[model samples]
Target: MEIKLCSLIALLGFLTIANAQTVFDITKCGATPNSDITAILTKTWTDACASPTGATIVIPAGTYKCGVVEFKGPCKGPITFQVDGTLQAPTSPDGDSWITFCSFENLAVTGTGTFDGMGSAIYGKQKSKAVVTSNGVQILDTKIGTGDDCISVGDGMEQLTVERVTCGPGHGISIGSLGQYAGEMPVKGIFVRNCTLVNTQNGVRIKSWPDQEANDVSDIHFEDIVLDNVDNPIIVDQMYCPSNLCKSKGASKVTISNVSFKNIRGTCKLPEAITMTCSSAHPCTNVEMCDIDIKCTTGPAKAVCTNVKPVITGIMNPPGC
Candidate 1:
């Protein structure tokens, strides 16, 4: 009876090993701890995603110098890229984004890691630290900094949640600058909560193109966020023409609606604490704010509103409209 029991136990252990999920450590696939591992990472990702059951690609703890790390897939099953180390972007990445997740489904990027975009080296040239275009995506407990937006969400993303993340020394979290390209898709159903922004240009911004209408972004929520000396604490910029480049002299093309900001308190680096400039042709609707408070260092914080109105309640500093 003892021998039979031992055999059964060994069989169960072997089965567990066989059925367990796979974890692909990048180190095993020619990724050095302190080198530019872009090519190695690409190969590792391809191998891991080829598994019959989805796998976890682990970026272990070290500073990995890389350029243009993009993971693209309609992967076989749910996939996870667990970053337990720092991903360092080159001074000149030769691309707009440092890291990109394109066309993925059910992807989760979670871990206590840092993504350094080397912003100061290439200020105003780099676009963003990370750009994500995926469905059922969750980005949690990560730190990001870049010259442009810390995290930019692309179109056609659904069921997205960004929580407990910190951003700084860059443009804050943004959605849109949408409606700029042909076949542009709408982004909806986003929830951003428990995030902190420090020393950033803009915080919690939603922007669209100047003219050429036909994209819609709706059903957004930003709650329980802390901002430390951010330039624009809360902004909805419809006339999002940089360097005065919009020649049409028309309102923005994108339509924004059903947005809410709740329990946000912080300091504004600029005098304009809150700015909501929507389009006259396609104004923003159903905007709501609660427990919003931010003060400027130079003067009394003020809000700049045009072409839209918001329902305000409880402790608005610059005062929303």
Candidate 2:
């Protein structure tokens, strides 16, 4: 027993020291508060990604005006980016995304800060407030308001969990616009819960490009969501024609299955509270809904369902698909 206890203590001590090895504070590393710190932040991220012990890059409490920032990685160890401040994007009409992370593992960004897009200046130009591509990502307790999707999970992502997030004045949480290109990676094991979206375009949507080859999206869940006057609130638009000019030649080939929506209640601005416009060739399968109540401002809430049948339990506002 004594030897075991000593071994446990030694393990704990080693972990403590390992965690303390690389801690980078952006403010101390030549980042100016309330200014465009894109250059400074990029350097800090590079250093953190290169750390042998992995690192924790802290964005302390302050306002930072940033441009397009991308953090790509295969870091040696686990990495954490703690945002305790406001990160705002510039008003560039050609901006892509405010902050983008790609090809990471075991990354966590958690705090009480805000990711502001100032999107009105360049509406429809910015894609998302933040886009992440990784395995094992946790985004918690953050507020996002942007031009496009508040938080979008791209391809090459798995085991993603998002909780306690607030999104608005933008497109809501989304999984795709996948299957756009060839050789795309499959996205799986996604959970989005305890989210609030207000005055957004869509809530909890999974969209895919039209006329693309088959892609697999499975085992996804969205629960405990609150929508306030949102349009097209709870949608799985398989034949997503963003340009409204998709050729009537072919249907979307994305295979959407095993998706669930539960405990979602809110108000819809339009009558179509739930729309599941799946592809005719490859329809959505095994979709489920429960305890969903959405009220519309005008007339009664309605649902447009096609190419999919859902398993429903509890009460659905306008009847589920």
Candidate 3:
């Protein structure tokens, strides 16, 4: 894995920051074009993290091949990782994640760059979970695609907002297959709005494992979304045992409540456009569907619901369940 740092002016350009802010450019820290910058980049982050005032680490415009890197911080001040280049991950999986930023008080990953995971090589063999375990996070104006879920909201996520994003060639945005492990925290206040999905397996789904530990998922909402040729446009699957792994484990103990799907219009590939198979043990409550107009390509669209009674209002093409 090597990074090609082509320009020197781009490095100097980032150094010219505000008076109180310090800049750490990888090129200045012994990084060269088409060379392994793992060590140099780590050193740069260390220096920036030690700064008393705020600091920014800049990766200039070029193609860089990087291995597994974890940027851990308990810095003295705020930190920003600014990238204006493409970052290509290793061909083979090195760790759970290609890049990780953890334990930061105030951190920003702002970039016009791309993080290419090189997932095509090992698509079906090994799938990675792009998990989100944070609060007060906002993912806006971005495009994401992968073999697995484009964005998987994992356990302990709250006040998360994903808006104006385009997702496709993937499993769309999801809120768990939660309750797999014991003592998992609740997920609340998730909002996904104004997104577009094309050729995805599922769109805007919330899933959980059956016969698992008890957990609460509430205040989840999906609004103003558009789907094209998607398999399942809107779904809430409590019996989400992929590959029939858990045969008949009583029912999911996860309690889902106050979920709304509003103003979502699109075309679905399957006739069952909306499927809400909630747990019989703890059925979903306060589920609402409004202004939904999804059509099936082959036949008439329909919705299948079990253990969930949604409050339907306005223009339901599939005739809300």
Candidate 4:
């Protein structure tokens, strides 16, 4: 077919020129709003925009303070850390993963900015955290406050998109405890839809079961959301993890296939708003819930629905966790 349409138009012009390299203008990197990125990439972007196939460093706004910021391979435009202000890190004596993303691609640290990992300016609890490795990611409308899990996804990541984000007071977005059995392409196409969590502890967490040989965190999806007073709003802890705080434990055997929680609306101080655990070697498959609405300050507001096939009907409070 004409050489397969000329090799799909030269692989879509080499992935649109590998996402269009470089662009940093954090107000010319001498930014104010309290600047001092401790040499944010040797003073504003590109100490190395890593090029085997990577580079897109552009931040336009103000407010600074940085640590452990890394991304490699496949980038064009959206490495944009564009916001109006704030991007911090430093505490826990200094740094662990203030912002350490891995094998990156198409990152968009959106506006309304603020990545303050002051993490209570660290004092232990292994000094708060951060880490998102290898993948095609897009984190939009950012405002993540970390002392822990304000975002952590590793092990050969895949398509990830945590859009319209807003997690405060830590430990919210997670994708693995891929410890103990060690690595692979575990985290798959994960989509955390329009998010919002305040006073957090565990707003939206999807993990592989506690170590054995944790498998694939398959095609998962979390829909339109909002939660306040969070303390375990939506979780899949899997059982015993973070190895009491990431010493790189284990747990995950893939297969959390096509999971979905659609039209989610919430409120949680946790009397069990949403809690999912599917393991038995990667169990929870093709799970779905539509129009879920939850509100809890007390209890009984949970309306569980398990492996629901064709039996879901405009659910209001149909939770069967």
**Top-TM-score structure, candidate number:** 1
Off by over 4 Å in 3: 1-25, 28-33, 43-57, 72-81, 102-110, 124-126
The Cα error of candidate 4 at residue 281, in Å, is: 10
- Any residue pairs clashing in model 1, and if so which? 310-321
Runs of candidate 4 exceeding 4 Å displacement:
1-44, 48-85, 88-155, 158-166, 169-171, 174-184, 188-204, 207-215, 218-228, 231-234, 237-267, 270-274, 277-296, 300-321
lDDT (tens digit, per residue) of candidate 2 on 1-321: 533443343334322345465666776655668887787778777767877777777888999988888888888777888888888878773456557787888888886676666757767664444344588888898787766787787776888989999888778999888877788888888999999999999999998888875678888999999999898788888777776756543778888889999999989888999999888888888988999999998879998899998998999898746
lDDT of 1 by residue, 84-111 (tens): 8988878876877667788877788987
Clash count list over all predictions: 1, 0, 1, 26
Candidate order (TM-score): 1, 2, 3, 4
lDDT of each: 0.80, 0.80, 0.81, 0.60
All candidates' TM-scores?
Answer: 0.88, 0.87, 0.85, 0.31
Best by lDDT: 3
For 1-321, candidate 4 gives per-residue lDDT tens digits of 533443343334322244555444444434345655544443333422433344344444566766665544454334545555666666643435445556666665566666665544454635334344556677777777766677777667778888888888777887765543555556778788989888788877766545555466667788897888777776665554554744433434546667677787777776777766555544566777778777787666664323323234486663564
What TM-score does model 2 achieve against the real structure? 0.87
lDDT tens readout by residue for model 3, 138-251: 666677878888888888777777888889889999999888888888999999999999999999999999996889999999999999899999999998888888746779
What is the lDDT for 114 in model 2? 67
On the 0 to 100 scale, the lDDT of residue 35 in model 3 is: 64
